[model samples]
Target: MKAVAIQSFGSPSGLAVIDLPVPAPADGQVLIATEAIGVGGVDVLIRSGALADYGFAEGHIPGSEVAGTVTAVGDGVDTSWIGRRVWAFTGVGGGYVEQAVAPVDEVLPLPAGLSAVDAVTLGSSGVVAHFALAHAHFAPGESVLVRGAAGSIGVTTVQLAARGGAGAVAVTTSSAERGDRLRKLGATHVLDRSGEGDADAPPGYDVIVDIVAGADLPSFFARLNPNGRMVAVGMVGGPPPADFGMTMMAAFRKSMSFATFSADTVPVSDRRAVRAGQFAAAGRGELEMVVHELLPLDQAVSAHRKMDAGEVFGRIVLTP
Candidate 1:
């Protein structure tokens, strides 16, 4: 089998494809013939050695999510899963390959009407947004804001909030064209990074999904309604919000809350439910799974380059 491994740490050039023996599934695992692999920000961090605590040494394979077909099952697994189309969380890495093995527990049958590419591209983002929104406890008719709204997770969060009956959906994007696109996809308003909404509301947002945590965070946090909360899910804005303490103190009178979300904190059963629901919503045409680019597995380096340059508006998928 062929797999792309981190030839070394640092740049996209570090990624190189190499031939490796097919991995045999162990107990409670299944081998998937890879079809598509999703690229994530964490993968980029790992490649650059910025996330050392979560990374492996050179020559490591890096992929956490994949969509493909089960070719074989390991001990304690059902044979019925064989030949079944599925997408899975491949532990931490090992997905930038032709064949990847994932735990049976992490594998979900690809629901009808969702393509393998769509699932692979949107799966992780959907799951993350679902949980983040749940943690924020957003309600119908409440106003919501999503930072980096043009990104994959932001797009999903925006649509899901709309589906949940949010009265207002504000997204932050630098491009006016992208903002217009998001408006068609259910965003009630799109603002530039300077925090200008299409319209003003003094009462402010009830829930904020912030992917960009920077100096601008405090201003957004200040916009939350009384007793409302903000979830910092990504760090695209370069740094953790400066004056975070001052920001919290400013919102203290209203009892506003601030927290971060990690998919690891979500239970497997709940994750399964979110994944299934997202798949269904997408199948019904309620949620759009955006694929900004699709490249062959061997073009992994080029894909990484695009992501690093922030040129990707949605998920970038690699097909094997």
Candidate 2:
């Protein structure tokens, strides 16, 4: 198997393609012949050793989403899954390779109207957007602010918020080109880079689907309307540096709520259901799967570089 591995914790230049022997599936696992891989900021973070809290070791293969066909299955897995087109998590982070073994429970059948690439592109992202919006209890006519709205999960979050009848959909991104593209995708207002305070919302937002939790987070919290909810999904900006406690106290007077969420918190069955729904939505063209770039597996280094530079407008998929 050919996999992209980080030889050291530093820049995208450290990502190297190396050959490894494919492993057999353990009990309850299945072997997939990878077709497409989803590249994102988390992969760059793990490659740079910024997310050491996750215990990613040196030479770790960083990948979370893979869309492919099930070539084989292990004991306790049904034989019927063999030869099925699917997308799944590699359990840990081995989806960067041409072949990966993932737990059967984590994989799902590819829907009829969706391609393998679209499946992996929207698979985890669509599921997370659904779960997060559900957690925030987003309602019609509510105002929404999507932090980091140019990325994969952020794109889906923005689409869902707008389609759900949000009276206003505000987004933050570094590129004007991407911001304009986001407007066509449903963003009512686009702020450059500084997603928090740049846009004016005199009444504040009813729900904030925040993917970037940086020093600007306090500004977002303070922008929430009475009884508004802010769900932090990703910390692409590292961590919050300001005194959030003071802001939280002030927001408390307005009955605002704040929380952090991860798709892993959802039960496996529920996760599967949400993912399937997202896949079907994409198939129906009700949701947009913005595939910005498709690169060969060996270009993993360049892919990470683009993500770190914040130049890519949408999801980047890798073909193995």
Candidate 3:
């Protein structure tokens, strides 16, 4: 098997491809012959050492989701899983390889017509977006603003909010071109990167799904309407300031609230159900799958560079 590993942790160039013996699935696990791998924001964080405190070290594989065919099943697993097309979660690492192993509970059969690329792109992101909307108690006909809505999770959020009957779906993107792309995905309004103060929404948004949490996060909280809820899911721009809670308190009079959400808190069965439903929706064309680009497995370094540079507008899939 060929795997990409982090030789060092500061730059994308640190990722190196090397030959390794194929790994066997452990009890309750299945081995997959990966056909597509999803390059996500977390992969960049792991490569840049931003997640070092979380135990990501040199030699880490740096990928979480992949889709392919199951070739082998370990004890306690159903033999029928073998020869089936499926999407698998390889924990925090071990997915940037030709072959990977995942727990049976972490694997899901692909919808009848879903391609490997689409499966990997929507596998985990769709679940996060769905759970985030549920967490914030988003209501139909409510207005939604997806801060930094260019990545996979952000893209999924925009589409889901629209399909769920949001009266207005606004997105903050880097340029008009990207905003135009998002508009096609059901975004009703496109605002500049500093979207919190956009003139289009003087009344404020009812819900905000923030994927970029940085020094500028406090500004977005000020744009929330009465009873508005904001969920922070990713901090790709960096962590918020220490006094960010003060900003939330300042808006307390309006009954606005802010929270950080992680899909890990959702029950495994619930997450799986949502994932399967999303996959079916995508297969039926009720949802869109945004894949920015596809690259060969050995180009893992280049893929991370593009993601770190903010050049990728959607999920990047790597073919093995």
Candidate 4:
């Protein structure tokens, strides 16, 4: 089988294609012949060595999500899963390959009418967005601002918030064209990447879903309404300053709160249920899955280059 691995660190060029023996399903695992692999900000971080301390290393295959057909099942697994089209979470690696193994419990059968590309695009991202909103205690009629609203997770967050009956759904993007596109998806107001231009936005948002947490993170705290909640789910723009917490203290009188959420904290059963629901909703046309581009598995480096250069607007799927 063919797989892409990090030959080095610090640049997309570090990723290289290599041939590896096809891996087999282990106990409680299932083997999948990947049709589409989702490229995300975490892949960029992994390739750049930003997560080296977290156990990623040279020659590490870096990918977390994929959609494909089940080829085989491991011990104690049902043979009925074989030949089923499904979306799977391949943990932190092995997903950048033609054949990958995932815990049987981590795979979800795709709903009718959902394609491999759409499944990988919405599977993990939708789950994260759904739980992030819940972690922020989002409620219908509450205003929402999705920072860095161009990626899959951000796009999903916007759609979910709007469908949840948000009074206003604002977003931060790099261009007006992308903003316009997001408006059609659910965003009511669009601001520049720096989060300016609130001429028509609400005075403050009741909940903020921040995917980019950098130096500017502190600035968004001021845009929160009294008793507002802000949840950071991704650090695509890099980590915030060490003292960013001081800004939250400055807004103490507003009774505002800030939190960080990760799907890892959610139980597997809950995550699977939510992902299944999202897939069903998308299949029913109640949710939209955005795909920025489709690249061949060999072009993994090029895919990461686009992500690092901030040239991608939605999820990029790698076809094997």
Model number with the top lDDT: 4
Q: What lDDT does the true structure give each of the candidates?
A: 0.86, 0.87, 0.92, 0.93
Q: In model 1, state the lDDT of residue 199.
A: 61
Clashing pairs in 2: none
lDDT of 4 by residue, 1-320 (tens): 99999999998999999999988899999999999999988889888998899888899998999999999999999999999999999998889999999998899999899999999999889999999999999999999999999999999999999999999999999998999999999999999987787698887999999999988999999999999999999999888999998998987899999999999999999999999888889989999989999999999989999999998988999999
In candidate 1, list every pair of residues with a backbone clash: none
Error of 4 at 179 (Å): 0.6
| Candidates ranked, most accurate by TM-score first | 4, 3, 2, 1
| Distance from true location, Cα of 130 in model 3, Å | 0.3
Please tell me which model should have the higher lDDT, number 1 or number 3: 3
The segments of candidate 3 whose C-alpha lies over 4 angstroms from its true place after superposition are 196-198
| TM-score of structure candidate 4 | 0.99
Q: Estimate the TM-score for candidate 3.
A: 0.98
The TM-score obtained by model 1 is: 0.94
Model 1 CA lDDT for position 223: 78
lDDT measured at residue 278 in model 4 versus the true structure, 0 to 100: 89
Model 3 worst lDDT window (10 residues): 195-204
lDDT of 2 by residue, 193-254 (tens): 66543435444888989988988888877778889999999887878876775888965679
Q: What's the lDDT for candidate 3?
A: 0.92
- TM-score: which candidate is best? 4
Report backbone clashes per prediction. 0, 0, 0, 0
